[model samples]
Target: MEDALRRQQTERLVDHLERMGPGRVWRPVVDRDGTVLAEGGGPLPDNLEEYISGVDFAGKSVVDLGSNLGFYSFLAARRGARRVLGLDIDADAVLGARMLAALHGMGGVDFEVCDFLKTPPSIKADMVLAIDFIGRAVVAKGRLDQVLATVARLARREIVLTMRAVYPLEGLPPLEPGLRERYAKHISDGKFHAARYAAHALGHAWKGRTIHEGRVDGYVLKSVLVFSSNVAETWEEQGGSS
Candidate 1:
């Protein structure tokens, strides 16, 4: 009964964030029961459970950069990671994630308010996650290279990076005629060179990858690049030199 009452209080905090705090959650925060505590107006998060499940999180430490609402961090903890840390610059995002963690009694994960781009934190983990929006966002703002370097440095064994605009590499969903025309040009003949882009930006070639074509704001798609840190470092030394 005490735990139930505590959850009720934490639920109220999440509701407050929705009503007057962060305004629009960039992504949905779903609990163990699959209930979305805070709704996201943006596109749904891609199929990440499969990705996270593939990682052997036993005895591993994981870091999630641009963690948003910390869904992945909680998921990592669920997957048996020894330690999980989520970092985001947004205070409300951090607060919402913390409340959700406490609400669900998920004490394995931690969230901190930190701007990875402006000030890289002195934390390291066995695996690093820069999922969904951070890749394209930093790219758009001319900060992808720096952010990617930090992501690589933060990882000791593996890195999972997902970029949004890699949509052009695959088939796009049909939009209205007007919207279609705009994105048709944006896709650039459907050849975005995602692998080459990742090699240059992150300075490492991906060992495996998957793509999810979900449109956003009328047009946009998603792609993910999963890298083994050991292989990436070796490749950087031998052949990735530009």
Candidate 2:
């Protein structure tokens, strides 16, 4: 009887995934019994541990910004986070993450649809994650400064910011028509470089320490910048770099 019930549950979960279409995802989301629910096209970030090296999420409140499928949020909960909230702009992704949490019985984690730039969550968190979000922002709206300011406000203790770094590589090919048209202005304005973007974005009085700086893929230079609210204020008072 138990085996039959388990099979039925697995079938239902698979169906749910099918309805959510498999596409560009950052990480693969799996169930408690190791059933793969969704498959992402990007390479698995095997260096995730290194990316979050010094930060400890145990007993902490974490907020994952742009939490497309809640992979990092689930990781935080698994690592003993007291509370985990996953926020994303995509309504479908948010719903899918919520369903996955329910399926895994992770009561400590929650998912919500939010625009991190315009209407961020009001609650502050011990740790915040902004992985793979900055690059897209550079192309989409070029409002990195506003986004970083909001992140600084929402983060209490620390923030883990991961973005593609600027490198001496060939320029990106033209995107699809709709996206290309949207990104043309920013691209022509030269807003895609990582260092320049960070410099402009973090113009506010926030201090950050580089945790990890390296290449995630051939074209992407993944960098993790860690920030603490208290430390930032102290650095600003001491006339240190923002």
Candidate 3:
């Protein structure tokens, strides 16, 4: 009986680790039940709480792109969103998010493993979060216009976007000379052109607020942009979801 029990316990632990991880979670600052946790190791997550200080999520629905561990998805649900859907490409991360939501009893929150580039979600929402996703895709895929259009379509009310503010490896490790030169051109082009390309895509439709931390000479920091449709403009005029 003892030997059988040990095997069962080991099987259960193996299953759990297969779903969660040793250090793979993007945001583990919250407990399994959504409570905040203080941690050591890496830097704290940049959820952009201050950006949302004035905008209320009550009764709105949110779709989060690249919702690694559902951190922002949980935030939306807790802030009174009627529903929140977190989409990621990683199957294990989506499974982890779903399992954690079950533990937290967060029926308003859901997660799916999806490749938005191929098959975009048919379900649109009041808000779309493309944080740390759009600029990278634009830079890497060279499909700036198409990607931005999809983002606009996903959002019925508002869009919250964030991008890395710096990209210059003037003093980094030695990459192969050709690879390094190509990467340097890519970085230089992306840094100069992504923002302008974004404006051409859909920035003209909505007025926005820009949020940036001052430049760090050698580090990348998060920069945010929040914009709304004509209907969502009420969020600014009324200080909450319209």
Candidate 4:
């Protein structure tokens, strides 16, 4: 009887995936029995374990911005994060993440559809993950300073920000006229060095520290910037003028 029920449940899950299409990111998401459910095509070239191996999320409140399929959020919950919130602008992604969470019995991790550029969540977190978010914002011509300020405000201890970059410099490279016009179509944003610069700027603005930085190999050349809290102060003091 139990075997029959398990088979039925697995069939339902697989049916859902067939109806929804492939995951936007976090490819080859599998079940405990190693059943491949969704094949992803995003830029996450590494596994979740490799991406989150060094971080200490135990007993922390974690927020994952631009969390396509709740990959990092579920990993944080598994790693003992007290509370995990995953937010993305895609409604379908959010819905799929919720379904996956329910199937896996991960009630602690919550998924929401939100545009972090316009309005970030009200809750502050011990750690915030903003991976692969900057180039899209650049294509949209979003204010990079305001975006950084919002991340700084919501992160109580640390922030892990990653973006695609051409050079390891503090500013972006110039684009040709043709390339600029192509980027305006929302296909790509050329290359961006603003994430590293913005991370450092936020560290100075909030009196934090640039704790770590390195490259993350993927479909594109990516860089990771980590900012750690160095001082204790009221929200008003830490929230610099926008």
The TM-score between candidate 4 and the true structure equals 0.71
What would you estimate as the lDDT of candidate 2?
0.66
| CA-lDDT, candidates in order | 0.64, 0.66, 0.61, 0.64
Show model 1 residue runs off by greater than 4 Å. 20-23, 41-47, 51-53, 164-192, 204-221, 231-242
Reference-based TM-score of each model = 0.72, 0.74, 0.67, 0.71
Clashing pairs in 2: none
Q: Highest lDDT among the candidates is held by which one? A: 2
lDDT of 1 at 141: 40
RMSD (Cα, Å) for all candidates, in order, is: 7.6, 5.8, 7.9, 7.4
lDDT of 3 by residue, 163-198 (tens): 544443443233433544434433553333334334
The C-alpha stretches of model 4 lying farther than 4 A from their native spots are: 1-9, 23-26, 42-46, 136-140, 165-192, 205-221, 231-242
What does candidate 2's lDDT look like per residue over 1-242, in tens digits?
A: 96676566666756766777776356666667665567765444344544455567899999999898787787788778999999998887887788777667787999888987887668998888887777653444445556677777888877777765442223544333465443333343444445444534554555555556644444344666666655644322433221
**TM-score of predicted structure 3:** 0.67
Candidate 1 residue 165 C-alpha distance from true site, Å: 6.8
Off by over 4 Å in 3: 1-23, 32-48, 51-55, 135-138, 165-193, 212-220, 231-242
**lDDT, candidate 2, at 18:** 74
Q: Cα deviation of 31 in candidate 1 (Å)? A: 4.4
Worst 10 residues of 3 by lDDT: 233-242
